[model samples]
Target: MQDRTILRTPLCDMLGCELPVLLAGMGGVARWELAAAVAQAGGFAMLGMVREDPALIEAEVTALRAATDRRFAVNLIPAATDPLLLDAQIGRCLDLGVDTFTFFWDVIPAVVRRIKQAGGLVLHQVGSAGAARMAEEAGADVLIAQGVEAGGHVHGRSGAFALAETLLAEAGVPVVVSGGISTGRGLAAALAAGAQGVQCGTAFLATAESFAHDYHKARVVAARGEETVLTDVFVLNWPMGAAVRVIGNSVTQGLGNRLLGHDPARLPREVIAEDGGTALMRFSTDSPMRHTTGNLEAMALYAGQGVGAIRDIVPAAQRLHLMADEAAACLARAAGSRA
Candidate 1:
């Protein structure tokens, strides 16, 4: 990788990281090990706690603190959580000395105020310019312009590049482009497009430290750009009616072109593996978590369009370093070409 200095941007300064890359805090995928690895690698790592138990969240935060002193952030989905549960989790984080947070779905004014009053930074994830303005008005310190190609429950209507450009023009805060970014060129492209940094989920899901099953990782590696589709069929229990990007699997194949139909309850719930089994919940966005058994291929394999760029499951730190180097090289080559 080029000198870490070469890849530094305003986002790096604000987040106190060495590089302008962020590992997306994907609820089940971006766990303690993966977040710590990326943070340790000089890039900002974010832990996803949208569906996490309060105790689990506390334990994970303690574990990451034990692993690295570098700055990291946590993600919360307001729509998916009850007010009491959300407050408990956030309180636990604050008590543990965590200050950086990212909010998905909708911005919670109370939560934002709590974090800020405690001297924390808040990042609000938005899918459009209007949402960006709303988030900025809500006092978000940073903005994550999420695009349509993002994995999990994507709420954006435009592509990442276009959304980033739009958000930069209207939102008076540093913008981090999310969705469909995986390679060094992707990082360079986001920077060139006027973004402070890029937040990547699919790329990190393929990392060695990720908690996704090995079979799921392999599926991500072998997937093509076109193999992914957006659908709301998986939201059996937590049906927000939002379309999620996922690689084609038995479940998706059965759903076909319809975005919403058929009851998820009719589908198989118990996955019997070689050892213990796991139950697939309706309306739950949990990816095949680590140690998940039984018909794993039938579960939601959440991934972005960048799945095509993933070929191997390397350590999170190694992947971040390589991406930084490749982005620096790409920008250098582009500059030379223009000259």
Candidate 2:
């Protein structure tokens, strides 16, 4: 638990856990079972708590609290300026009594200050050196360098390689590299490229405990190269100009055709109630809920190039355990000799 192994990255030290692995905070796809399983597996799993109803988050976290006595994290989306919803999420999470939290999207100093003052550990997520610098100044315990290759909404133009290298060269805090990590080779590669640890998303998306819809899960299984496109088709439904990468389908692919290139914020926004409904079911274990179902043709299929690496559906614990085991052995054997 305390050696110079790949798992002993700064994340392990920051979270006070044994392993440096963190599960993807895929909303809807991120479920209670998966989070708990990861924590139980000796790594940390983050609960994606961006758009769900206040009650749903409360229920899930309450269950998570009962399940794992180990260290875990709750991820929040802050790109939008939804005061009511954001406050509700912070309130619920605080009520659940979680210690560590990962803040996604814009850097809100007040949230960071408030959380710190309240004794909660906040890890600010950013996409560029500018973002990372802002997070460090904001007092983030850790900075997650989420590259363009990562799933969900990306806030930085900097790729994983450059952002990570740049951050490590100057930043004072620990930098965890996220986006497109799948193979043990990827983990080895990221570390060799100057990352303290790698955060895996697409790999865990194929797991069993994930609440992603059956149809959505199948799409992940059936996807091929270049199926993904970056647009605000769905994000247009959001309040701001949030650009997310997803598989280009009918409703989604047409967004680009609809315009010759314009501002995303200019597009129409979806009703919060409907948008909330869609997100909740997109990752339902049994069936695709609102978020997963309605967007099927052009749904937000947030994925990375690592999609090709996912071969089978397995349990959450087994997934993290296997990745750790593989990364360790892979690093050891690779480090042994290059000849």
Candidate 3:
């Protein structure tokens, strides 16, 4: 096996991780179990706590801490979450001594400032060069350049590589590229393009440790890259114009002409599923989690363009090691080609 240490970058030192890989802080899907497994495997793990209550955040953080002592982050979406709830979430994270945070969607300067004031490290995920600059100025320690190929609540129109190239040139902070990056070849490509690291959601989400429902994981394993669709059909909880990339399902297919320019508020709030006794409505951004039941196919089955690469559901640690080993081999091959 290739020495995986050869694949490490400066980002590894900064994040206290052995691999320059980050599990995308996918809300609901990336919970304590997945995060702990990834962290134990030497990849940076992020607990996806988007719009979740502080109590849940505290409980998840507690579990994560109990599982692993390695550095991890709590992912939050300030723009999408209620201000009071977001505040409480941040507070809970800080109280738990979690110093690293990953913020996605719109970059809220005030929220960034608050984290920075508390001496926390902020990794802001942005879709455009403009947002990159904003996040950098707002005191981000690292910037994650998210591309349109990313699953769930995409913000930028440009592809991953193109946006990454632009951000690498413009941002002072270290940049990590996200979207459609599943395999080691993809990781090697991003590193060759000067990205410090790669953030992956779809790949990790398909793992056995992921909190996503088994049905959702199976769909990702069976899906082709083109089988995924980028649409706003599931915007019940998020703001209007918030686009997401999800595996095509009856909900998205049934949209037909109503794919765009329809008011989500006007749509019927039909309960399609249930998560721990809470109703999961149709058109809601909530993806099917492990505990969720009823009409799983109709819920948002989020997946990246890299879904085609995921053929099986393995443990998160196994998946992370495979990615690292592959990246090392790919880098060696590239270097040998140049020689």
Q: lDDT of all predictions, in order shown?
A: 0.83, 0.70, 0.92
Per-residue lDDT of candidate 1, residues 1-339 (tens digit) = 475575678888899998999888888788899999999988998998876778999989989989999999999887778778888888888988888999887666777788888999998888888778777877899999999989878887799889999888887789999999889989999988889999999999998999888988999999998899888777754545667899988767775577565455554464334323446553346567778766677667899998898899999888888889999998888878999
What's the alpha carbon RMSD for model 2?
4.0
- Model 1 bad stretches (over 4 Å): 261-278
For model 1, what is the error of residue 298's alpha carbon versus the real structure, in angstroms, after optimal superposition?
1.4
- Identify the runs in model 2 with alpha carbons over 4 angstroms from their true place: 1-6, 255-295
Q: State the local distance difference test value for candidate 3.
A: 0.92
As a whole number from 0 to 100, the lDDT of residue 238 in candidate 2 is 48
Error of 2 at 20 (Å): 1.6
- In Å, residue 133's CA in model 3 sits off its true spot by 0.7
- Residue range 228-264, candidate 3, lDDT tens digits: 9988878898988788999999988898766665578
Local accuracy of candidate 2 as per-residue lDDT tens digits, 1-339: 212265577667777566677786777677788888878877778887766677988888888878988777788776563788888888888887877888887888888887888898887778888878888888888888888877667777677777888888979987888877776667777766767777777777777887775656667666753676555445543444566666556655455565224465454444222334444222111124334334454456666766777767888777776777777777777767784
Residue range with the least summed lDDT across 10 consecutive positions in model 3: 256-265
lDDT of 2: 0.70
